[model samples]
Target chain A: MLSAHDVTRSFGGLTAVNHVSLEIGAREIVGLVGPNGSGKTTLLNLLSGFLAPTSGEIRFDGTAVSARRAWQPSRLGLRRTFQLPKLPARMSVLEVMLAGGRLPAGASPWRSLLTPGAVRREEAAFLDKAMGLLAEVDLAGLADHPAGGLSGGQQKLLGLAAALMDDPAVLLLDEPTAGVNPSLRRRMADHLRRIREGGTALVIVEHDMGFIGDLCDRCLALDKGAVIANCRPDELSGNQQVVEAYLGRRRPGVPLRVVAGGTAGAKSSGARA
Target chain B: MLEFCLHVLIMSAIFGIAAVSLNLQAGTSGLLNFGQIALFGIGAYAVAILTRAGLPWPAALLAGMAAAALGGFAIGRLGRDLAAEYWALATLAVAELVRLVALNEDWLTGGPQGIGGITGLFPGLDGPARALATLALAAALLLATALTARRLGETQFGRVLRLMRENPDLATALGHDIVACKVKVLAIGGAMAGLAGGLYTLYLAFIGPDQLLPFETFLIWTMVVLGGLGNVAGAVVGALLVTTLYAGIPFLKDIVALPSDLTGSLRVFAIGSIVLAALMLKPQGLVPERLRRLHAQRP
Candidate 1:
């Protein structure tokens, strides 16, 4: 479980996220949606400890993690993916997955040198585990391929596989379906559902309304760095402010809620199509 | 001819030890350190000073290694927030700063004249016998360090370092303390370089500030590049090749009746051209690094 209190992050004169607070419960999937420059990614960055908040406190299962290094929160079982997946040019896909596994002993230089037998055994087990995860993401065949050479969609899938390698308690994904094909996007949705059933929580920042509407249990809509709507995904269309933010100013004669509802349906349908 | 061959072999093994260590840092981890000689210098000076203060050979050698490790750790710490290029420049500056200290501190470092008359590891043996013993010692040390470096490279620690080199942010996301990893690598590399320095001093019975020049660091880099950057065995071979070339180039003066001064610069020119050819023709070096297979034999 994770919670933030009045978190704000700014860069120079730009206030990207202002007085935003959020909580993510165990096994829950929360969708973060907003138009461009709405601070969705910034909020995710702040929550995942990739970037420190300009002001506010964040706690993960009761431990303050704001002052900790990005890696520290990760050790506490919180993991995140970038908007554009980070894959090194020289690293094999399997190597990337192996790096993601939780094996502190094998990571120690001393243990690696002095007790190589133990390290080898640990590595063999992890190699199997990583291979299995890669298979789940339909990347088992490309395990030996240089990760940087993979297609964008494949890279995103690899990113997911790598993050899952940590067996993280909470996973934050930024636009996982951004460049993915429709079939792969559907597969990812199924994967996330299984992950939630397995007791891990998720926070997804996405512009794909249909994906968010179908997958998210709850949704938060933002405008200009402030939360404008907090409701079930189905109820997002009924929120007047969210509609105005997405579809622009309402016509004077018609009830804005109905217009908002109609447009949300059209948008989600178009997105799915 | 036998003595000349042994001299070349001994020098190659000594420099090979340092080259292998540098490979672990720059080749394996992508640290791109440009101050490698400084760590080597620290080791040499630690031995020189500690021996002068009446410390035994083995103890003085270890103390030199520890001192060099500390210097390496300091460089790693300073580069924590720097990008790769800036960090490289910082390493260069630190190396120059170190050379300056050795240059200016006359009483401690014997000024430009350097310290001499240090005892050799095998003082009782004379002539070729002593050279043979020193060659054997250097070869053994090189073998040990190379094996250790190779073992470390095959482990998950090596995978983590590759990740750090390739994508520091991603490595961090995977819960690796990258700064700590950098420091650890530098320390290990520094210690190995230190060992090589101590052996060099013991082999020659002297050391000077001139040996710590920035050009020495570039020579190590060329060794790493000429061998596959990430291949441990390649580093050793590269060192041998380069050292042999350096030693043999002066012989051309005899055949061609060249000017005396030209031989010194000729070696540098020959090395520079070989590096360029290597880069353009076989950028992966003589022994290109292979990707670690998941089903590869366990180390």
Candidate 2:
């Protein structure tokens, strides 16, 4: 389980994440939903140890990880994926997956040189495992292709596969479905369910309300770096604060009909006009 | 002519070793190390200074390697939070600092005049035979370094390095201490460069502050780029081609009757042109690194 308590991060005078406290239980799929600049991604970064919070604590499996290095959380089985996949140029897709796997004993330069035969064997085994993961993500055909050459959707899939390589206990995925196709998105929703069933917790940041409502058990809606609503995913559309925050609060004299038009000008001018 | 040929071969081998070392750092690890010659210089100076202090040749050589490695580790540590471009600038500054120290320290480094008349490894052999013996040693070390570099690229350590190079954030998020990885890469590369420097001093029986110039680092970069940035074989080929071109320039001067000072300028121009042409025409160099098709392999 992972928990963030009163975590606030400020850049200059502007607070990006303000007094955010949340808990992720084992195998739970928590959807983080917010408008642009709502601090969803910043929250993910803070939770994943990519950015140290300005104040408060983030504990993973009861270990305080707020001051730890970004790699330290992942070493404790807290993994994450970027909104834009971070695949390097000239590196093959399969190699990316292998890098995500359990750090091999042969990863030590001394062991690699001293017992090359064992290193080779370990690499061969990892290679096989990587291929299987690639197949699962339908990226097996592109395994040898340069990762940099992958399309946005494919790169997202590769990011997921790579994160899964180490069998992480918790995965913080930022916009996994943003560039993905509808069919692939549906398949991914199913795959994520299967992953959760396999005991891996997931915190997904997504813009697609339908995807979140359909796939997530619970959803947290954020507005201006503060949590506006915390409710079951299906109840999100009906939550007044969530709707007001996402759709914008209606003017005092404006008819609900005019507000439904959802334009700045239309909302400012009442339906009576 | 034989002596000239031997000199070219020996110099090519020595520079070849340094080039391969640079490729490992710049190519594989994605470190933009403009201080490479400083690492090389540290070894050369360590050998020259420690040997003059009456240390045994083997001990002095090892000391030189250790010093270079330590210097490299320091560079890695200092550049930990810097972006690649800034880190590169920092390395350049570090190298210039080292050169200034060598130039200013007269008693220890023999000043800009440098230490000379040092004993060579094969001093017992007659002139041609001695040159041949040195060539043999240089060539053997070059081969060993190239093979070691190749083997290193195939290992798990190499995979992590490549990952760190490409995406440090992702590599770190995947449970790798990229700082530690960077330090290890630099130390390893520094040791290799140090070895090349030691061999260089041993062969020429001399070393000076002039040898630690930033231009010397760029020369090795040219070799790495010409040979195909990440490929060990390419670095060697590039080193051989460039060193031979440099050595052959004196003969060109004799044939063309060029001014003596102009010839030195000409060498710089020639090297600059080759690097420019290589970047524009064949950016991958003569021998590009082979990408591993791990999916094609069976368990």
Candidate 3:
């Protein structure tokens, strides 16, 4: 459903994403794994049209979409969630999702003021759709809550629900499980799986190897802004470069420990464990 | 006492309109506009100029609102990319520029002599007609603004505006044309300010550059801050209270033999103290925005 050909982005002299190519098919959950500053999020930004690639071609549903503005790409069914979960502090969770639902295609000021009945009808439909999406993410009860009031994990879920409100053909999520609790993380993974099954293409950036392994159908690893490996989850985990990049070689007598616990320690240890 | 209450109600209704408009820009849109008085000034001048041009009161009032909206559109376009402190500075500059224009523009604004003899909403009728008309006009504007605020609160545009205020980056990523939305709101808000200016001109039967000072801008800010920043009802209440204190404090001089000249300064001092007290006591204003209530209910 989405394709990036030789995408390259640079900041001054430093290249953030270099000649990276990726493809995400409909109903596919593709995992993008990398260390810090590896350009996974940058790649997502370029694809979602938040940042224009210095050089590359991005195609969404067979149309070239590399140079459009962020909001413009959204019309073409390209949606994204930020790594930081950019929820508006002044807006309720429902309002935020309604914003997504009310994408330019759904409402305009002129139409809204002139055709109140039609706008109300569409608004009701959109509200139902937003409510359903919120329920899917277990945020139905928190719909009236301000988006800023959500816990980190809940905000991440709401972010995904908001993206889904657009009825996106492809959703790009940046670090969905980054700061979430383990249970919430697991739920997020499961939700991603359901989203994939429901036929939307997903490209997820994550540091959690377990999440990638559990939720993704295919995985790609990046090192220094370049793709190092692209394969099935098991193969990706075992790939020599991927393993080397994520887990440096242990000394001969240093016992390699795989500490498994909650998300807080896991995140800290996962970085340099 | 009854006269004082009526005066308070009238002044409150006027300020409520200003505060609501200011809140729409600053509280909801997150645009630090320090030049709102410019729009207010334009509104008053529009009415003044149109009335001098022999237009009827109602037509002059609408013309004033249109003028202010046009000014707002100009400012919004000019300050579109400015953020935070820079935006505030730009708006302040614009307000000063407008004031200067009003002061120097002789033929149109009467050039410092000010404009007077402007008729009220009803001219032929005596006390009751004039008072009723003023009250009715004020009520009509307040109701219109309240309805507008309610509609905006529920709409997608309102959500985007709030998102833009909190985090423009997120709003942009989520498919909001932040600049366009800001411009739209700014113009609409300017129109409201203009409406207030028109009403003020009719009520006082005068227009002067002195009314467009930065101090007046701060007064509007004070009203919004006293009322919850994002709460429409809070703005209304705050406007009423502030206007009452402003109009009534002069009576204190009659009771206490304070210097007559000190009344103006004391009234301003009183307003500043009240604002400071409100900030300390209820920093979120009398009625905080509904977002807080929603969030508080969350598990």
Per candidate, the number of residue pairs that clash is: 0, 1, 0
Off by over 4 Å in 2: A259-273
Q: Could you give the TM-score of chain B for each candidate, in order?
A: 0.97, 0.97, 0.94
**Model 3 per-residue lDDT at B165:** 84
The TM-score of candidate 1 is 0.94
After superposition, which runs of candidate 3 have C-alpha atoms over 4 Å from their true positions?
A: A62-68, A86-90, A103-114, A247-273, B1-7, B291-299
lDDT of 3 by residue, A77-187 (tens): 888888888677667888888777754423355554556677666767777898888888888888878788888888888878887887788998999998899988888
Q: How high is the lDDT of residue A149 in model 1?
A: 87
Interface RMSD value for candidate 3, one decimal? 3.4
DockQ, candidate 2, comes to 0.74
Choose 1 or 3, whichever is better by DockQ.
1
- lDDT against true structure, model 1: 0.87
What is every candidate's C-alpha DockQ against the true complex, given to 2 decimals? Answer: 0.65, 0.74, 0.33
Ordered list by DockQ, greatest first:
2, 1, 3
> Where does candidate 1 stray beyond 4 Å?
A250-273, B296-299
